[model samples]
Target chain A: MMVVIWGVVKFIVLLVLLSVYVLFMTWFDRKVIARMQNRVGPKLIGFHGLWQPLADTIKSFWKEDSIPRGSYRFLFWLAPIIFTTCAFAISFVVPFAPPIKIAGGVLHFSVVNINVAVLFVFAFLGLASFGVLFAGIASGGSKYPYIGSQREGAQMISYEIILALTLLNPILMSQSLNFETIVAAQTHHLWYAFYQPVAFVCYLIAMFAVSAKVPFDLPEAESEICCGYFVEYSGMKMGLFPFAQYIVLLVMSAIMVLMFLGGWTGPFWSGGFIAGFIWYWVKVAFFVFLFTWAWGTLPRYRYDQLMDIGWKILLPISVLNIFWTGFALSAHLPFF
Target chain B: MTQIVFFILSLGTIIGALGTILCKNAYYSAMWMISTFVSMAGLFVMLNAPFVAMLQIIVYAGAIAILILFVMMLMDRRVLNNKERFNPQYFWGIILGVGLFSDLAVLAFKFRINITNAGKSLTLHGSNTKMVGDVLFKHYLFPFEIIAIILLIALIGAIVLTKKDEEEAR
Candidate 1:
């Protein structure tokens, strides 16, 4: 069937494009961060350090794979494999832009736009925590990684709830779990960010925490835990975590754009497929660039402080934001 | 194509469930259980209930399995030495498991519900999520409220138990 063939082709294309995007992101991130820090990053490999990630990838992938002694062989293998799978799977539902009309047929940019895309997104994001938990626990009984995994588990457990709560803002407004409908809602109304600023702020903080960016990167804090969960890992095994994190960053940025930033819709180019794709790509790029700037600027959060922020602060604000959004909507005010 | 996906997912779930028990190491058992949960989610998705699929993964695999793994992590590694592979109850356990499986198999075939035309039968409005909410809020409202009450009670009980543990630790 044409549908089946198209599905297979789309899967293959998504996989290749995802890898290429992740690889290039390494250089993109380093260069942007370098600019933030007033230094040149990876200029030798190619123009303005474009091919730096390609060189980095080749070196990391070809290096020897070794498992430390006393490691549980099965789990040592399982962690990174599942971690990367979950990370890549999260990108499947992210739409590049709104649907475009081509030859009088509508084309959805997402790989699969399911009925309950919101829940699907939350589920996979939650699943990533298990990979971190197992990776730390299976590190040959290392005390350091065990501690790191515990913190990782605790942080994800706390933040995932807040993230789920914050997601309700757009879900409430659109009353649909489908990403396409949510974007359509945004296109009709103002971006949710302008309407639900409280929820938006809470979600922004939780998003960084979820992706383990700086200020929330305590799980694998290089200075303190000395690589934490992947401390004993080397070569591609070690490099895979960063690769997965890059994918997570992309997914998170894409979701924020879709949910809050009026995905694929900008001025002067409102409704065309290619134009919407371009607009979506531009917004996502801007988000990634902003994230790198934050990564370069912020200090990592202390462990207890991270927990406090997730539970004590963001959790309550997010829960209250739901009520606030509901009240505002009920009032039917100009802002609402 | 649907049959192929269902076959693959069902086989995976069965294999994972068996592996969960067969694997002597606690950590591997937890991993197998998680995989089983994932396969179950795939089955839910195949059934065209995406919300249930998400909950299956999020609640069972993400939360429950992670909790089990946390306990597995704290355990002394030597205690899992698989010295005695089988317990004395093994014979009865197999018999009971087989008995349950056969009963379920018969019931599964007998009670088909034939959900292919259920949506048409109801002629409900809106998306699947909306239909689910409408049914839960209108027809099954009492049971839904009861479930919520039960869950809240369970949560409070857990908090109390943990608070007790803290006091005893102090």
Candidate 2:
């Protein structure tokens, strides 16, 4: 009963955190990008537009919802909900810290500590592609959205294998699929990043690909497809679409921290709940910052280039890394 | 609570299955199939198979379903126009489905299932993953290797079929 209650409380907290993160990330992206272009961004409403994300949220909520004629109404509406919910739910199993002793001596973490938490996160992330595909198809648009959806679907599917294989390296090192076990393993030795550099790089590339960031942002390729799959979306609908993207970003960063960064492991701090929480956030924020920085520095890849990097470069490397990790583990070598 | 979850799961799976057959557009059908896959996975979790449930979502719902959807898109079939013709087949499909369901129901009623009332909940034993791996590599080794070889052959065959045809056309 305590576990159930803790789960509910954690779910609520995580949802609120994700909602705020999504809103602010949008504002941050806009402001950062604008500054890069030597212009002030979102400076109108609140102190250099600090309140920009909130304002945008309100505007989206108030905007008239429009459904395209001949669109499949059920699927069109269902897409965003599935997309956002799956994005939100994966965080439930992810440990933000060591379990906390709460009222009545109930032990709790951010979410349920499933044994297969790592795999669950990947599985949920994989579901997000369906939302994009459904959104494109249900729009009943010309060939452009279809083309965009096709690209997005193919890109996601291809990158997903690499992501899983890259993740397998750390899982092999820890000899467990549980997120908590992976973190606990890291406390004894160096982080998995030291040994699995190839996997780390592959994961980083795949993360960018999955997030549809610069170079891999083929789904929303401007100049050619015009916002690509989301061209037809408007008002709160578009807001939901970007909201899902931010959630994906947060979840991906969180997973990266858990799998590679020795989640919540810091010097001088005992592996308590508060310590774990701080470490988890710090690592996630660093990665999020890295994602923003990459957005500024990197140019978008050509469609063919993006596909080539995914299939030709990252996929093979990840496969090789998996084998190497497996061999190292079997031979009792210090792989991590 | 379990019943409530089961109800929701069944509703989702049934609606998704119906949508797969009833929808005019192939893309929409594929989306519904994905929904069915995900909901079925939830059922698997409810049955205490979290690993299998995750695999179902990751492999089938994630990779395989999307692959099918992509192939459907690539084929560019005029799905909306063909709905009228496909409607007649649905009646036969439903009859066959009902017949199978009833047969399974009768079989299930006839069978006596013996379940041990273990006082303890199912817990994963230490090195369970290793045990599974050992079984796969030892007893099932030949079959595993054969499957890998078969997959490789099929992959090569596909590459030959697609690549050579494109070259010949060029």
Off-target runs (Cα >4 Å) in candidate 1 are A267-269, A330-335, B80-95, B105-127, B165-170
Best by TM-score: 1
Error of 2 at A60 (Å): 1.7
Q: Which TM-score value belongs to model 1?
A: 0.91
Model 2 over residues A1-336: C-alpha lDDT tens digits? 867876788788888877887888988898888888888889998888989889878888898888888777887887777777787777787765666566767464657877778878878878878888877777775577778888999889888888888998888788788887888899998888888889888888899899887768888887778888777777888878778887788778878888887888876675667777887788899888888888877888888888888888888888877888878878888533
DockQ of each: 0.64, 0.59
Query: Highest DockQ, which number?
Result: 1
lDDT (Cα, 0-100) at B46 in candidate 1? 61
TM-scores for chain A over all candidates? 0.95, 0.93
lDDT of 1 by residue, A1-336 (tens): 765676577778888988898888888888878888899888987798788888877898888888878888778888888889988778777776677666947666677767788888888887887888888867888877887888788777788888889989999898888888888888877888988888888888988888888879888888898878888787888888888998898888898888998888886667777788888889888878767888889888888888888888888888888888888788986766
Cα lDDT tens digits for candidate 2, B88-112? 5678877999999999888866885
Candidate 2 regions with alpha-carbon error over 4 angstroms: A101-108, A267-275, A334-336, B77-80, B83-99, B112-134, B165-167
Q: What is the C-alpha lDDT of each candidate?
A: 0.82, 0.80
| Model 2 interface DockQ | 0.59
